[model samples]
Target: MKIDFEKIAEEHIEGFKGGEGRLDTRNYVDDRARIMYSTLRPGPKSGKHPHAGSFEVMYVVSGELTVHYDGSEEIIKMGQVHYCPNGHQHWFENKTDHDVIYFAVVPTLG
Candidate 1:
């Protein structure tokens, strides 16, 4: 199946997932998973949290982000991907001058 993100309305969220600043995203959610195209602005971050019953995969489309995974810091650049397995903790931060655009999918565990 094909998903057209352009057809989805974008939402600007403040303190997304309890993080600072805002996140602009277009999301498609169902009982099984959530797929999204998001842009993380500079100086903002995704709140640190654990994936209790789901796993997340994020592919960077442009720019970069600093991912705090578990207890370490990883820099995910354009064309790179970051995966957070179930039961792991992670968060994303955009500390650069440009926006960090990415595609993410979170699949729920049965």
Candidate 2:
């Protein structure tokens, strides 16, 4: 199956997961998975949260992102991918002046 992101409506989320600033995204979500094309504005971040029953995979498309995973920090630049396995906690931060664009997928587990 193919997904055309250009047709999807973008949503702006403020303080996503209890973090600062905003996140702009176009999403495709269902019971099986959550897929999104997103942009993180400078100074905004995704709050640290546990994966719980699912795992997330994020691919950086442009710019860079700082990830705090399980008490450590990681820098994910363009062409890099970051994965957060189930039961782990992680968050993303955009600290540069440019926007950070990425694609992400979160799959639900049985």
lDDT by candidate, in order shown: 0.95, 0.95
lDDT of 2 by residue, 62-83 (tens): 9999999999999999999999
The local distance difference test score of model 2 is 0.95
Candidate 1 residue 100 Cα shift, in angstroms, is 0.5
**lDDT, candidate 1, 1-110, per-residue tens:** 78899999999999888899999999999899999999998899989999999999999999989999999999999999999999999988998999999999999898
In model 1, the worst 10-residue window by lDDT is: 40-49
User: What are the TM-scores, per candidate, against the unseen true structure?
Assistant: 0.97, 0.98
Score candidate 1 by TM-score against the native.
0.97
TM-score of 2: 0.98
Error of 2 at 90 (Å): 0.5
For this target, which candidate reaches the highest lDDT against the unseen true structure? Answer: 2
Model 1 vs truth, CA RMSD: 0.6
